[model samples]
Target: MRLSARSQRLLSLVALLLALLSALLGGWGYVNDSAAVLLAAPLPLLIVLAFVFGLSQPDADD
Candidate 1:
């Protein structure tokens, strides 16, 4: 299924927000000495990157 341009943009925005939240949580965890949280923080960033990469790709129909 293809998303409209607006939907893609919205999805990207949400992904970014999630990444930001994850980073903040990671920072908090770092300050608190929680290794588990720190390790998990980067996962959302990877997901955001994936979303960005996927969105940047040209549609096969193009």
Candidate 2:
């Protein structure tokens, strides 16, 4: 798949936010001693993967 540079940048930003949210969730879970929130680890990982894929794609014009 190919994506324009602008779209790739946007996706990367979103992915960064997802990772931040995941970290926050883990912190909250730690504070409250809950394992459930920490279980959401895979979600951010998936987002990061998507970000990597987006970066790997060529621009539409290329």
Candidate 3:
């Protein structure tokens, strides 16, 4: 199933917000020496990168 253009944009925005939050947490973790928080940070970033890449690709229908 295909998402509407608006929905896709919304999802992208949300993913970006999550990425920003992750970065902030990662920085805080680094300062606090929290290994768990540091390790968790990359996951959201990877997810956001994957999402943005997927959005950038042409759809099969196109």
TM-scores for all predictions:
0.47, 0.47, 0.47
Count clashing pairs, candidate 1: 0
Better of 2 and 3 by lDDT: 2
What is the C-alpha lDDT profile of model 1 across 1-62, one tens digit per residue? Answer: 45567776776677667556656766666435365455456667767665776678788899
Winner of 1 and 3 under lDDT: 1
Error of 3 at 49 (Å): 11
Put the candidates in lDDT order, highest first.
2, 1, 3
lDDT of 3 at 47: 69
lDDT of 3 at 27: 67
**Candidate 3 local lDDT, 1-62, one digit each (tens):** 44566776776676667556656766666435365455455666656665775678677898
Which pairs of residues collide in model 3?
none
Model 2 regions more than 4 Å off: 30-62
Model 1: lDDT of residue 12: 67
TM-score of 2: 0.47
How do the residues 1-62 of candidate 2 rate in per-residue lDDT, one tens digit apiece? 66677876776677567567766766766434244345444656767666677778867799
